[model samples]
Target: MENQAFQIGKASLLTKQSMGEPKQLTSSIVILVLATNIVYISNMLNLVTYLHDRMHADIASSSTMVTNFVGATCAFALLGGFLSDSYISRFKTMLIFGPIEFLGLASLALQAHLPSLQPPKCDTVNEWNSCKKMSNLDASILYLSLYTVALGEGCLRSSMASFGGDQFDENDPIESQQKSSFFNWYTFDKSLGGLLGLIFIVRIENNKGWDYGFGVSALVILFGLVSVASSFSFYRIQRPRGSPLTRLLQVIVAAFKKRKLSLPENTDDLHQLDIKEETFGMEVLSHASGLEFLDKAAISHGSTGAWSLSTVSQVEETKIIIRMLPIFLSSLSCYICNPLLVIFTVQQGNTMNTKLGKIHISPTSLVIIPLTFQIIFLVLYDSLFTPFARKFIGYRTGITQLQRISVGIISMSLGMCVAALVERKRKRVA
Candidate 1:
């Protein structure tokens, strides 16, 4: 009987182990495909900007579209972060938002050639002067479609990153190492997609047409969706963190009560459940405190421990807002240089090429240079600089995110300066 029991236990363990590997692979692939979409869209921005120039849009008009789109994206990102952390599982959020991104790309492509489907052309002087004459329908559709994409992207971006972080068991050292490796390779893969977009999509636009180029981007996103969906069965669902909002509210109520009670200092007389900050505050703490508060509120119709919830909730809101500020700052700075790169390339293709008497050059083709340089730099940073620093600095202080971020930002600023100088020279020759 003992021998038979041992055999059955071993069989069960083996079956469980066998089933886990496939799921892990599926989850990794899904995240990878999602990351690829970043490069796809970034590259598409270059293509569309190129087309905007081709279509004879004035400088301000062309810049405005990119600025508006980015502004909408930032707005959506904040909302999406809350949704991801509160109600929806990361996988479900992606499933829902990813489709909206697809829809946005579809609209961009469909409306590219059809002027009637889009806002009036931006070529005329003081176009806003005639804004009252044009129906809001076209502008509304354009902004709405763009916003839909922003909404989806905002939700998916951080949730997916957080989800990827969740994939590895921090308790397991081997898997932890694998997780780091996954992120490094993940960033590389995104750059790869960007490179492909710069080469293929840009070439398509230059040779074929703007509509076709954007259509290709839509197709790429569709492929990404398929890749991610295929891996859906493998993902593990993670619950969101605590409800900072509710906690803050409780804290507020508590302050009021403490003020009202004016109870003796250090009053040990009042015993109430204390809430501690945890990973899933909304799921764990808020739910518990909220229920307790509601019960108390029902009976006393007053402060019922709601003060603690209010305070914590307020703190959570502030922290989340603070957390988002950096991303917005970085995104804004990056975007400022983004269109300029494409515009510089277009100038090279037209006037610069004319002066140099070179073979046919397309503005889209120059986009590949930055992407190539980026990949090279990324690898160099990860392999060479990171290790050397770890060996020297890690032995003393250790590698920190702040240091890396500072270095990258300074380097990016320097790169922008060089690009500006290059553009100025190009303009002079033109």
Candidate 2:
């Protein structure tokens, strides 16, 4: 199929007379995030415990299981991106994926609730073979259900933020400013949900049971779906503009095909959108500096076919992605082992004296510490740090994206080091 213009280039602003305004869109998204994230955070923070306590996995095995499940959920986001851009609108992608997640949560609840679906709980599962571990069939059932949840949540992760951003008209001055603030609000909303999940939901799981927790999560996601549907008529749906990966590949193939072509004296000689097509809704990216080799794709070749020739804008998009590759690759290092901290913390808390008067502390609820700090940091960075940093190195965000990521990487490393020291000290004392 032909590309439906590139990357939501121009939205036609489809809407009912009084609907699809920013106010309505904002409220809908707030509800959606609150409903979606609280449960997501609760499950993520508690999944290892569930697998170990309910599913009869050991500590190491439980962490590995939870890690793989989380990784798979992130991986399936690629499907979300591909389909949302190439086949369906972001709204529809949410609608489709939401129910699948609910099903998975429901499955997990049923499995945890029913004794037949679980392994026999014992004092020492693998020590002296006092009791059998989880059966193979039950393990398969668990994996299937967990993977189903991963698929659904992964796709929703890809769509939700972008769908909210798509509501504002970037060209309009007021909306553009609002668009900038929209993401900050999105972050706040997400953190609020996470805080609630970390504090309240985890407490429920510890006091009540895993089945109750999973059941609650299922209901929350279902509420999110209903919220999204309530404002269905108000969403300014982003038109799918084909797979961006496909466009990038086209640039590579076209450049390779025209490798022998000479560079143009004037960059204007490079092809962009056709005049008639330009009027219709294609994004017009001007030629960017550097990566001149890829510019060959825009040279006027004998064939008019897409594989033989690409627009200058398309080639520039390819160049932008190429330049940003290092940042993306390096990001893995920042997150890869960081999640293991949670598993360790949960286990450590289990061994600690967790009583505060009459209150019994849930180990997972410790996430509130970091969550509180994050919110404080966000506020300080925006209100205080921005002004201070602007005097030295000025940018709208007060620093470049690269700088933020670099600081984050360093902070994460420091946090890990501290965790290691604390764990080492605890071991010595024990």
Candidate 3:
């Protein structure tokens, strides 16, 4: 009877553990991510045309507006990351920002549906070239709605990946492996969602109407919010560490304050919050070389306390960010090419035979071709290329992250070169 009671207790404990584990959390979060991407990408795919056709903006003005909108969305992601790390928890950040995005989409849809909110309809036959510019009121409404969506997108981009990661515990070997798998699948899911938006949603916007497309996107985002909320009980929430920017600032200030202080020969002489371990009680990284001046922040001159003194971890954190800046800047080449490609591709598609067999394809929908290729390439790399490379190279891994990034940079440069050549050919023919 005692043994039976013990077994029953064990089973109950196992049941509770299983209940809390991240079995379906990835699926739930992926759905939210998928929905969000669909909303964002669908709008973006046709934004140039929307500005040109509906708002009566000139080509240069429309192109500039689209470029600025894209830039704002990317930049706002940093603000979102700051908010997530500093004041609000990731879950709360998502909950707040998700609604903001939904409202923006709703406002955009309302603007499209209400004729008064739009510019006077262009006369395609006779007055197409002489269309009136969008009035101040219409321009204000359009920009305000776009920026609102950008703000929400920025927040979600910063928070969602980290929030999804928080669901799995790294200490458990099985869960840690699952977390790695989650990242791979999550990326594929996002790409798939973007492809769907480019194909189906853009088609609807072009064939049926703009109002219907925006309305559908708004509804899809609302559904994503519901899906996320449903899985709240299962999510593992991480508390925000005090702002990383503040910590960086504290290190800089402390380092500058003690600029005249002499360098110590022994690294052990440096002040640390925990002497036994480095970086949050984990002995993962040894003290990195270079930026020897920042190390002064960790020097114990006197009992000046927290502002004047910093842990080795804090000083190292700042140094790590400084070291990564170059790599980050290098990656921007790909992003610079993105908007230019979008603008040129749409213009080219307008002049090309866009009919695929029986169906007429929108120029915006051409985005799906690259997206489909990306998905196929990713699948091939994961399933075939990686294993072959690993074996051929006699290494456990196929390629280093930095090497992969370099390859991507080279590929992007080549693509841009090819695009320039194509443009020149088309112009020569014309």
Best by lDDT: 2
In model 2, the runs with Cα more than 4 Å from the true position are 1-23, 124-128, 275-281, 356-358, 380-400
Q: For candidate 3, write residues 220-267 as lDDT tens digits.
A: 888988898887765666666766778889999999999999879999
List of clashing residue pairs for candidate 2:
none
lDDT for residue 39 in candidate 3, whole number 0-100: 78
Q: Candidate 1 overall Cα lDDT vs. reference?
A: 0.56
Q: Give the Cα error of residue 124 in candidate 1, in Å.
A: 11
Each model's lDDT comes to: 0.56, 0.80, 0.79
Q: lDDT order of candidates, best first? A: 2, 3, 1
1 or 3, greater by TM-score: 3
For each candidate, what TM-score against the reference?
A: 0.69, 0.88, 0.88
Cα distance off (Å), candidate 2, residue 32:
1.9
Total colliding residue pairs, candidate 2 = 0
Residues 193-229 of candidate 2 have per-residue lDDT tens digits of 8888887677778778878988998998999899888
